[model samples]
Target: MKQRHEVLFKQLESYRSYVLSVMENVTEEEAEIIPFGFKNNIRWNLGHMYLDQYLWIQAVTKEKCGVPEQFKSWFGFGTTPANFNSETPSLEELKNLLKEQPAKIKDVYGERLEEEFPPTEMGMHTIEQVLIRTIFHEGMHLQAILDLKKCIQPSF
Candidate 1:
């Protein structure tokens, strides 16, 4: 079980690195530029990744999330661009949050595997299940960021 957790942890770390690398060269304007017909911007996508991960991992695990209330609704499962009006954190802030996530997740996993995770409208999930979904969700957005980058700054 520990070995499985380690593997999942490493996979999450790799995906985190991939996300950071994609955002490294993106300008502020580029981050906010929504591709035509797309509902959310890159900034929203990045923020959503952090918010959702924190919600599932920390909130569900009965750990301290420290998420600002103002940003909470932006991350709700059914939120769309039409309903999400908050500004995104700066690129530096987003990167810092990403940097902190792996350690936080490891610490939480170390302390609380036996406890039940919180229920959601999407239904119940084990800790491992939540982590897997979070990883997949991040990958989806990372691909979206790539697509947006290609559209906004083709020279890169």
Candidate 2:
């Protein structure tokens, strides 16, 4: 089971790389643009994925948010990116943090997938299920980053 968890964690690392590639060379202004019909930009989508994943872990493990305090308000699930003016972490900073996340997850929970969590309201009883859901969530957001990239690119 731990070996399976390791594979899932590697997938998470791949997802992070996918996000970085999708966002490569994106400008802050472009990242903040709310293209027609989209709810967020590359920036918000990137940050949201991180914060949302953190929240999911918190929910499943009863652990506190390991991310910065602002993540909860600025990029937390449902936090909109439109007209954002306040100071937020730069994309590079976020990128660095994003890169560091999976290693941290593996260090902390790598061997503990069989550990039982409080029964999830959503019915996830083991760490593996919760982490698998995390991978699914990351994949969904990775696709969103691609969608946003298309929307932000100037259509000829």
Candidate 3:
């Protein structure tokens, strides 16, 4: 039987593919365009997804953030500010990272997570619970990207 983590891994893999397909042929301007001013650009959302995963699987695990430092600020957890500078990785790089990250997590999933991730803290979840939260969060953003694409390019 597949473990819960395995199931989640598969779902995350599909979500990653969905995100990539949405942005595959996008121009830089389109990637950065924030439709309705209420949502983040696709580029920022992608980076944030990467960063959130990295923080959970790596930072929370007391391992390295596998992604480059120069691009960290753009996607680093708790770093998304309304007026923050947006730095984007090339499409090739982003696609590769999205593909690579799930494998990396699977590789390390069996290792004991050293940090104590409490279920709640001050009426909120601890970091571990937050990681699970991010999985759903990424899914929501992926859907948003699809909706945004339809809005921006109706014929697509």
Candidate 4:
């Protein structure tokens, strides 16, 4: 892998580690709490984090996304906890997926980061560029998670 790819993957891993660390103490019930003024809970944000990367990568690579079909309906953009069913993944499940995802992504795409795609509206034409965008998106959801955490655990 190129030095830049190594740095990008390290950034991805570090960000995911920070997210997991923040969520490590959250109980399942806490994860499910949709605090006032928030459309979704920490659980939804986590699932959205898992789903968004796959969706964006699919868009750039034109490969079929590997996540289950229900992911789109339950965790895709514009989705909320109201859309969840009994079949929705538990927080533990989502966390496990999130924990493993950076490694999985590196394994799959590490060598392909420089591969060019048609430019997105944002002019992102490489897998590396797409990964950068996803990292920013993850930060956005991380903020949402922190906000929900503070609401659910005022002392947190």
| Candidate that would win on TM-score | 4
User: Lowest-lDDT window of 10 residues in candidate 3?
Assistant: 119-128
Candidate 3 Cα lDDT to native: 0.64
Models sorted by lDDT, best on top: 4, 2, 1, 3
- lDDT, candidate 1, 73-94, per-residue tens: 6645666545555364666777
TM-score of each: 0.82, 0.88, 0.71, 0.97
Clash pairs (backbone) in predicted model 1: none
- Candidate 3 on 57-143: residue-level lDDT in tens? 544445576667756676665554353443557556666787787767667553433246433433323333444666788888787
lDDT of 1 at 21: 83
lDDT of 1: 0.75
- Cα deviation at 72, candidate 4, in Å, is 0.7
Stretches of model 2 off by over 4 angstroms after superposition: 82-85
Give the clash count for each candidate.
0, 0, 0, 0
* Per-residue lDDT over 1-156 for candidate 4, one digit per residue giving the tens place of the 0 to 100 score: 889889999999999999999999999999999877989999999999999999888888888868998999999989988999999999999999999999999998899999989877778888898899999999999999998989999999
Better of 1 and 3 by TM-score: 1
lDDT of 1 at 71: 60
Ranking by TM-score: 4, 2, 1, 3
Candidate 3 matches the true fold with a TM-score of 0.71
